[model samples]
Target chain A: MGCDIIVEEKHHVASRTKNKYTKNEYTGLPRKTGLALRFTGLWEGRCLRQFRGRRLAWAGLVAGVLLMAAGMARGEFIAVLYKASRICLECIGVG
Target chain B: MAEVGPGGMGRIRRTVQFAALLITNGYWPGLGRIAIYSGPAKGVCVPFLNCYSCPAALFACPLGSLQSMLAAARTLPLYVSGMMLAAGFAVGRLFCGWLCPYGLLQEALALPRARRVRLPRWIRAPKYVLLALVVLLPVVWVSAGAGVPFFCKFICPAGTLEGGLVLALGRPELRVNIGWLFAWKVAVLTLFLALMPFIYRVFCRTACPLGAFYGLFNQVSLWRIERDRSRCRGCGTCVEVCPVGVPVVEKPNHPECIRCLECVKACPYGALAFTMTEVGKQGSGGTPRISNFKVRNGR
Candidate 1:
């Protein structure tokens, strides 16, 4: 009984594939291959589209926060301030 | 309330550049100590390409700071990099457009009525090479105790102008140290200045490593130019007006765009607009709110 149901499901998918290929007659791809390709393209597009609005904002925010944290932890920010505060005569070749 | 043209923005930018130059080099007019401003403010890096060696400069050049930091101990240039990152994220190469003294000089020189020539696209590659050679190589060489701020020492016209020329003019004692290096830099500056009337911002388009560095962030910077596809007529007006020759209809935020907003003002169809996203404005969708309605109103 289980085997029969599984076979029926496969048959249903094959028929749907054939119908799609027939509707777009110019594709020339085999039914299974065309279905697979379409599914892949759709999946990729969906993934990329998800990165658009809120996700991008979050990513930027996170990156900024992490960079700040790193800057602080390394005392890099202080070092920059210290360097900028002093004069390097060598930089001007005056030393 | 008259509709301002790109020329108006150019005027505004020129004024801002002049103001910045004065503020950075403010101490000289008073005649107290005309040496490099070795004050506390020197710890901060200004966004423009002002040379720190200038006797009147109040802030450090980020590139010079970066090279100095790197040459010290392969020290991670946290302050310079962080400042650059912040500036890049905030406004990208808008610094080049409205703040850089050198850019201002180029703009001023370009005012002469000359037959303008468009630079070939491939010339854009050399700035990246310069960034690598002048910035990255020195960083690597720093580990060997051979690291020098090669670009500033050899190639920077700002240093030559503000540090070399200004110092020589003001002090005259420093002229004894003037050698072939100074002459070479003067020659380079002369070549760039002569070319400016014919090719707008030739140094910026070809060899400004600092501009190149900021340009990398143009694509994702909070400050951006947007083209409303709905309004565009594909007339190519923006391309004609762009100083850097960016094809804005195709790529609205081309890295080469200095964010001078000439295209924004030049768009006949009211398609191009400047916009900015609020920092930390969460979940606001990637949609940028229109910041400049003038372009939209097409006045």
Candidate 2:
């Protein structure tokens, strides 16, 4: 039994050395790759470090869309955008 | 071996070139009014986003005109400045190199052997942040796409002092309604303009949203100035000479880089070179890489 124990320890050491020495092919993707793939336009510098970072940018985008849709669906906001654009053009000398 | 040609010569030539471009854009002949005539026709200005709105403006100033376009846009292109983005992608940030009238201002301010002031990191992000609040925020808010000219309304020392004040001072009606915003603008303008003589284009380096816009072009532009690591000695002279606060050793296409060519002027070796042919010979070949490249950042 003692000899079997010694043999078992030797096998473990051999496997440890083998694991250390082996050079595996780079088949696996790094874990961070998943995170990077998921986020877009959030972390421009990094993966979304900036203020318009994911949360705010998304909220703003949603608000902008809703505001726009509501305005389009309704009346007053429709002409206001058009009118504002015209005024802006004229002011900048393109109107 | 260095980034640009010799300091004094490259600086002078580029300065003269910038002045010529600005004049071509329209600086009232001597003040660079000529810039107005050439920018639209010439198409040589690829780096700096020139204003297309100024009556005297010959070349297109991207930001100034972009704001107007956004304010006016009622449709699908929504939020994106197609032409502007293309131009930026094509040349990256080369406009800071060849064109920018304001970059020339900082270079000129650096003259008469004056001491320069380095801005703190706390302020550097403000320009980009301001870019958001000024450009993106409004576009998102309006949903009509594109941004309101918030810089002009709230911050721009140029518009406030150069155009607004100039127009307001001449017209009484505008003066009549001049409320807190005007005073606020004028006070800021006064401080920045005053600082211009002493602190360099403190506004451009620190606060100019237009500069920030152009800085976005630094990465992909063709004949951009690049640092060849093999040739660079890691000397910090480029930083010392840079008016807009770019760290010389890193890379030229920084968001803050006005493409003034000062670091190109500052380099001791010919490591940095502005090119058009992508991988061709440096300045000695003199192919004039501009003109042909489309302003991809625009429509």
Candidate 3:
């Protein structure tokens, strides 16, 4: 009786997988076309699911902050500072 | 927590914007005379688009600074770009929503109107084109020693409103310099002001290159609005309330999202929220919350 139950469970799992593919094949496309469509759908699903992870976003922020800090340390901001102190002639349309 | 309605949030945002304007342009007194603050703090770049030449302006405009940097050298505008990037990453277009004086003006004008016209999606593309034109065309002219900040001199209504109007009014000597260019700018500013009531943030939606830059970072900014997919009912309230007309349910973190949190306040099920989190982790609800996160809606 236990052996029979295991066979039935395996059959249920296989039928569920078959149903999933059959749902995708409902358009009545050629076999090769259906396979291609299924592959594309799976790829897109994977991409959308993976795209939401926060690690890449945090990495970008950290990199941007480090670059900004480095620029400040190197005195790149000094030019803007000096320029801002004096009146800008061209900006006012007088120069 | 009770949710603040869009109107309440708008008032708070306007108050902050007004405060920012006063702080940045505090030198202006009620008297007819106006004095530009030539302080050390002026060297710092503000994230918004206040005119650098405005007599009362205390900080530099980033777009103007970028143009100047490019006009002076063919190399990349490292300092200005870096500063803007830092701001963009941290808050996205939060500065536009909360700090821009012009944005405040548009929002104020929008308040009195009963009717608003929704712009088509294609109208959003021009700002990117304008950004390219403003940054690139002037570089070539600068290389030939004939370049001006083309956008500022030719197009920016902010410069015309803050600098031109104030200078023409306060400094009689500068009045003689007002000619066709000033006239042209006045016409543009007038048109923009007239359109504000009918169309929300027309300049920001269509032509503000700074908005375009900040919008680029909205997808990855530290502060963001997220929708809990499991809880969302797709009632479409967020779309209706959004000033920029973003389809928030489909893409909550769209680049065009200004991080204004209007959708968060509008969500009936509390499925939407504003949070400080990594880009992919926006829906996790695990990060620190921004102060004033609660929005109380009036019955």
Tell me, by lDDT, which candidate is best: 3
Model 1 Cα lDDT, one tens digit per residue, A1-95: 99999999999888777777444223332332221222232244444443353344335545655665676677765665665545443455433
**How well does candidate 1 reproduce the true complex, by DockQ?**
0.09
Once superposed on the true structure, which residue ranges of model 2 sit more than 4 Å away at CA?
A1-95, B1-6, B9-55, B58-60, B74-80, B109-115, B140-148, B276-299
Candidate lDDT scores, in order, read: 0.66, 0.49, 0.69
Give the Cα error of residue B20 in candidate 3, in Å: 1.7
Q: Which stretches of candidate 1 lie over 4 Å from their true place?
A: A1-95, B1-7, B29-33, B112-116, B142-146, B277-299
Q: Clash pairs of candidate 1?
A: A84-B42, A84-B43, A85-B42, A85-B43
Q: In candidate 3 chain B, where is summed lDDT lowest over 10 consecutive residues?
A: B290-299
Best by TM-score: 3
Of 1 and 2, the candidate ranking higher by lDDT: 1
TM-scores of all models?
Answer: 0.72, 0.57, 0.75
lDDT of 3: 0.69
Candidate 2 per-residue C-alpha lDDT over B40-150 given as tens digits, one digit per residue, 9 for 90 to 100: 242222235344333344444445544544455533232234444544544545455455655555545554333356677788788888877655544555533545566
**Residue-wise C-alpha lDDT for candidate 3, range A1-95, written one tens digit per residue:** 99999999999888767765443233222222111222232244454454365455556667767776776676656666665555554565433
Q: State in Å the error of residue A17, model 2.
A: 63
Clashes of 1: 4
